[model samples]
Target: MHEERPEVGVGPWEGELPSEGHYDPELLSNGDRRNVADKYRYWSMEAIVADLDERRHDFHIAIENWQHDMNIGTVVRTANAFLAKEVHIIGRRRWNKRGAMVTDRYQHVRHHPTVEDFVVWAKGEGLAIIGIDIFPDSEKLETYELPRNCVLVFGQEGPGLSEEVHQNAEATLSIEQFGSTRSINAASAAGIAMHAWIRRHVFDQSV
Candidate 1:
């Protein structure tokens, strides 16, 4: 008979484990196999979220969820990886969470009944709404300097942004695709846009 290999996560704790408040006794005893990073192993879900909250970036991610878009899950996961300030869902509160792989549990998410409501919230937070879609007046993302405090808004998967949302945006930007396809997947586009912001506000600045 073949022996089962060890779990992908850390082994059960030995002597002198971490502090009481930070670690989860169940996880520590069973060996932490959550999707979180190694430093967060054995850490309580609340502790991990609190730690992430302390370092989250100024930028937020909002998705137009009129159709319960599957891409919203991927966007949430990516947002968590990039440590976005929050993830906003517009038009619908329910979305497919399969792609998020439980990362949504650690993310701060809010729902808006409509684009108008989302715009109002953004305005209240003093965040500039930058839509990610290509149009006649849209600027290439490569040339645009993403604001330090802004919400990168993505629209529906196929139709892209609604006319009203497009019109209300302070500015719209698009990725330059070299392929014959007119557009890429919505989640991929969101990831690219977030990376662009990170490139300018985080990576490049640090260098």
Candidate 2:
């Protein structure tokens, strides 16, 4: 079962409001209960998005949606958590958004009709496409030093990355598993891959 949401909401303002452009009058009066951090309470959506845009990492997330994979929403939500520069959907334009929990509103998402189009765009943007999946020749994610600026690509749930994506990607990395299962869920893999990038580019830099 899911845990309960917080009961507390931002209380009404006590004194004169500041001149800063971040505050929202309506939210200040009517408790802000949005699914956001305390720091963003009572702030306009525009303000929150602007703040996020300033610090989003350079890496991007791309997923295949040829089969209308339900995992796409989860991947988009995870990308938002990691603050990826953008999320690219290759194949179908519309996708199931139920798993995203509205986080897609804060994310920058794009669509590509085909793998060829995605590859061409990636090349033009100078961002290397690194496929995430398990294969005989795939490198271990634990040791792989991900590209500083790259697009992390994922595939549909059951099929994994298409042969076209695999061939076009600069390299593919796989997460090691010990159990009898051949692979983890695509959404889980996407989260792990994104966090792996964070560990290398964001977390490692502070130390």
Candidate 3:
């Protein structure tokens, strides 16, 4: 559940209202943004993020950003929704943020110049790294035992996991594929892998 904070008055609105304003004053005056869930309505970005940080999940999310994939934003948004511990970007310095809708501010994101840097960090943190790919000799994600505390790694949209990343993975698992397409979208694949981890380790009532 989300927690709400009391609003702090920064200042009064200064501009005169336009005849045909783009946004509703009632919503804007109350800091209500329709892009977020109801629980976050009328709350400042910092407040929402603080609330999320207080109850974030254990799993981390990492994506290869070599192609400037727009899907990275979607992945970040999903990670925020699921309350991931953190989001890591590997292989590129910049990614398209338009799709994230500024949700990145509410999610902790780290950047690694290469896959090796990410692997090193994961090892130091004692977090297992699981690669999501459809390579030969890879295990089926459905049957694999996902770690309760781990980094879920995903590759670029078309090329999939780089050789170094595939080799560094504690284990590589593939989602079931049946259509003519050789693989699914990277963002969609990430959502699947994250949910699998959640179902296996998190959703269990005894936890």
Candidate 4:
């Protein structure tokens, strides 16, 4: 026989129910089972998004999805954790969200049909486009001083950044590798890049 699954989050509001506008009536009456911060356990989804918008980091994250990369979901989840301004998806409209585990519901995700459109949008937003990939002119990501208002773009799992994106990028950065593998995972690269930004701007730590 299969084991019974344990429930997540809190079970209903204990004692006096809170009357805050952010609190969801249903979740308070029933239970808050969504994977969220303790403070936001009973908050409505819109409230959580609104609060996040007020304090989202200046840096943005973009990923290429020409081949329907599965890593985008993980990238979104990481972006949410880091409170990224937004996640830009270049190429396909739909991507595999299993890795995100429903974090997308609280994170703002935008889609671009092509690289050209993405570049146009980034330029309009005054965000520098920094690509993460290994190329002849790629600089070490560790040494790179990521712009405060910029979008760190990553290619799909296999091909890396497309030629168009590479050409349009302000700088293509590469994470230093030690052992056998030539490159790291796309989602992993995104996390590293996002943390680098956080270290630089949020905690005022050198990357």
Total clashing pairs in model 1: 0
- Residues 25-112 of candidate 1 have per-residue lDDT tens digits of 9887888878889889899999999999999999999999888888999999999999999999999888999999999999999999
lDDT of candidates 1 onward, in order = 0.92, 0.92, 0.83, 0.94
In model 2, what is the error at residue 143, expressed in angstroms?
A: 0.9
Shift in Å, residue 169, candidate 4: 0.6
lDDT of 4 at 153: 96
Order the numbered candidates by TM-score, best leading.
Answer: 4, 1, 2, 3
In model 1, what lDDT does residue 87 have?
98
Please provide, for model 3 over 39-64, each residue's C-alpha lDDT reduced to its tens digit, 9 standing for 90 to 100.
66545566677778888988999999
Looking at model 1, the pairs that clash are none
What is candidate 3's local distance difference test score? 0.83
The alpha-carbon root-mean-square deviation between model 2 and the true structure, to one decimal in Å, is 2.5
Off by over 4 Å in 2: 1-8
Per-candidate TM equals: 0.95, 0.93, 0.83, 0.95
Local accuracy of candidate 4 as per-residue lDDT tens digits, 1-207: 999999889998999988889999999999999999998999999999999999999999999999899999999999999999999999999999999999999899999999999999999999999999999999999988889999999999999999999999999999998999999999999999999888888888553
> For model 1, what is the C-alpha lDDT against the true structure?
0.92
Give per-residue lDDT, candidate 4, residue 34.
Answer: 95
Q: Per the 3 Å backbone cut-off, how many clashing residue pairs does candidate 2 have?
A: 0
